[model samples]
Target: MGGEAVQTDITTEHIERLITAAGSHGVTGAIKELGVARTGSIVIDELVFRCEPPRNRHAVPVRIDLVHGTEKAVHVLRLADGEPVTSSEEAPEDACVRLEFDLAELVTLVYGVPRERSAGVHRSELLLAAWPRLTAAYGISDHELMGSVQRAVDSVLGGLSHRRPSLNELAVRYGSDKWSVIHWFTPHYDRHLRDLRNEPVRVLEIGIGGYAEADSGGESLQMWKRYFPRGLVLGVDIVEKHGLDAARLRTVRGDQSDRAFLASIAEQHGPFDVIIDDGSHVNEHVLATFDALFPHLRSGGFYVVEDLWTAYCPGFGGDDENLDNPGTSLGLLKGIIDRIHHEERDGADPDHVARNTVGLHVYHNIAFIQKGVNAEGRIPAWIPRSSDEINPR
Candidate 1:
């Protein structure tokens, strides 16, 4: 033989250990071995890896620079060699050749590295079959590995004042156009709902749209589903939305103003972490739904009323001049503010309002009610009996 090809020795055990540790420290654990070198030159004429669905929206393309030793004959896995793609327009210019993996998929594949492979195999059909076959072959028996990799990527992307994607990003990702729903609404949602981003929550959104047609609505429902990857999104509308049903998403036809019907929906699929009234925009319907459902919200859950401006318009049930209409949804929400400060009144009854109304946030056309027992202890006002007692700290 004129020349011999050096075999690149790699093993599943080493890759698995590296990934396992990366869970705790994020992708930083694997960066030392896998990160692209500061200098661009490399001697190895070997495989290059490029991953997609990058950790951040503004993510630069990442590469690994591996240096294989001729003496050891071991294959070195390095970051891909390329300038980081900084802009969104540049990312998909050549989307076809790029190997994209979500956090779990990449970790699972890394854990199944085979021993002593050729560079040719890496370039062949092996990469295409790697995900399922490798995952099935070596198998990540420990569930922790999957979770670690997911957290690792998220943590790495979310570090050093790098915020997670905003609702606008989710909207763009899922094509929801939630921003058009209300200009200021999505940011407020991101602020309040940040903690529940990754939770396996049950979300109920009222008003599935579609009008009288069975194939019509559920735009916001789709948005909610995409935003909460682990969430179950359910919608209730008066119109039958037979076409919108899918895995993790379900819709029911019902009347928002009917207390019994509303109660039944809750009974069947409630105790929800988030509930949004995006339905009729009718004042009576809004008040009726809140009274029926607010009591059922889980502790620390959120209840959002979108389109509150409808409360001041007669079509939905309000007088533009009189906000004091007891029958109007706006009036009903205003009363809750009184209840929030109920303890401040001289003869206030502690049990008059639900003790769990922790906070109420009002915006241009939205109202966010936070549910939890108001844990702040209060002291009743007392006239000082003596001068020394008046200044008591």
Candidate 2:
């Protein structure tokens, strides 16, 4: 269903101009990339980007679709250097695994990785740009990790987790312990999440930074403001991420872990549809947030906490509740699994305060989540009626 194309002269200026034209609607278009090094042309509609092509030869036109998004998929099309090649044995269409990148400026954006500078353009982009040239541009066929992504599915309900950021990225970010931030991949991320589900959805992103306060109106909130147009959003951070699309968003300031804060949230946005814990990857903070707010989640709603791996390493451990070793969450989730699968045997008791909701899965990826509900699509267990309810497993 997805294919590539060949165009000429795709430049930054051209992209900028087109995006400007997009205004409120945002840019929606596609590009055809090609070449093997200083070879073919990079065309984005009428505009063309001048860049090197691939090395192995052949001028085959690779037709790829920016299917998730036509206008905002500029970042995904970054790999498509425009040069219409007829045929080539190596980079063939049948090749299921492919990694693409812009080769020339690998160092600064990567090695000697620049510390985050809020003053400049969106920091994430600067870093990704320095990545090694030409890496996997689409579909990852990792047999083992598929289940991991599946776990993520049960945790979030709608979001799809792809094996993004290639091997070189792994080596670099994890290798140097470098903080690999992301630049705005606009259309790609938006398009992807949008295409993920047809149902209308809203999300609550918590834990923004101090710099992103209201006085200055931070960029993070602004980014989400535009990204999710149809869906509603509620953001909570220690410091506000300003410029939120107030028309469709609610920005609040409170402790991400405080019960009072959580209650206020429930009162204000009580029962969010999707909650993302992108802030304060701390254990106590995570546990506290989940404990109080999860009950308020809509049935079949999504509750997510990013950076779950922190529960393992001792250095990153925050509070004892986080239970760093096997992850407090893992222990909790495992018990839930036991409760759900082996009910009645070992405290399989199903009497929960928030009864009726189903306990689905456990995972230790970048984030952890609880992603489902009962047949009624409403949280089944408001009150823990079973013995397991008295003592959280």
Candidate 3:
């Protein structure tokens, strides 16, 4: 199938099943079901990984193919100084080194857990023959050609390994502001989400970052993709993010404050395991999004709110003087605390947030609200309601 055809047929469920098959059936069996075309589309076309810079200053075009029986899907990638500048199905006319693998082996390398070491890389014999021709035709020295090949091999191996960088490391690598001086949110995320690393969970983050620039943001989205190896991560932005979609990462354009829009996105893509509000940070916008999206969060999932400092900033619809202002995000959180203990108070009537929320963890400028059944029965009415009655004062 052509790349377009593969793209049209492939869905999130298709990719998730491919990952599951790789884990359960092993390479040989998975190849029988996955086929070469769909595997190539996922690895080369969808998860277009950024490679480490080549040791040499020259650019290299490496062709990768997924082979299943006699059928193969070929993709040529041009890498310059570590960045993947171009990718196409058309093979280059000029001689170049080629990397080939069984279709299922490629799938295992991309989706298997770190402990899985069954996937093997196979280098084509033509690589040896191409070196001499490359030296003569391109005027590249034998040493330079070898360096380029080594770099290409290293880059491919790095991506294929299931072992991933930590959230902080990925944050720096992807240029996200999450771990920087302004906000140290990665460590907290790691603490909360480390257990869910291998599960096929859906994650939604409200903000897409780079305000208006179409191509500038999505650093955190990349970090989440790496952090949750089996996750399907979605980012919602007010502006269109033209080139940010990837194998498991998707971007949707919408306003966070619009309850209907939030509900629609959640309905379409969610029952999410995690929902993070790193959006506009305007207190009202944050509050509105929480109310609209929290119900869509799956039971035992986490709903996170970042930039709580905005709750005190007047410019962002916050009131510093009245910290208890019910209009702000912090105020809403304070109210939830009461809801958590709603059973303790006489004549207390719990609302939706109170009925569903089981745990509330608040840090300096962020909070993680755990969703679950909050229905521990209230104190028995037979118990004395007043301290005076109990003490007999």
**Greater-lDDT candidate between 2 and 3:** 3
Write candidate 3's Cα lDDT for 283-375 as tens digits: 889889988988899888899999999898999999999989999989999999999888887788888888899999999899999899998
- Using lDDT as the measure, the top candidate is 3
Ordered from best to worst TM-score, the candidate numbers read 3, 1, 2
Which 10 residues in a row give candidate 3 its minimum summed lDDT?
1-10
The TM-score obtained by model 2 is 0.42
Cα lDDT over the full model 1: 0.56
Better of 1 and 3 by TM-score: 3
Better structure of 1 and 3 per lDDT: 3
Q: Which prediction has more favorable TM-score, 1 or 2? A: 1
Instruction: In candidate 1, list every pair of residues with a backbone clash.
Output: 63-79, 63-80, 64-78, 64-79, 64-80, 65-79
What TM-score does each of the candidates earn? 0.58, 0.42, 0.86
Give the Å error, residue 171, model 3: 1.2
Query: What count of clashes does model 2 give?
Result: 75
Residue-by-residue lDDT tens digits, candidate 1, 158-214 = 211113346776565444545865455788898899788655578999888768889
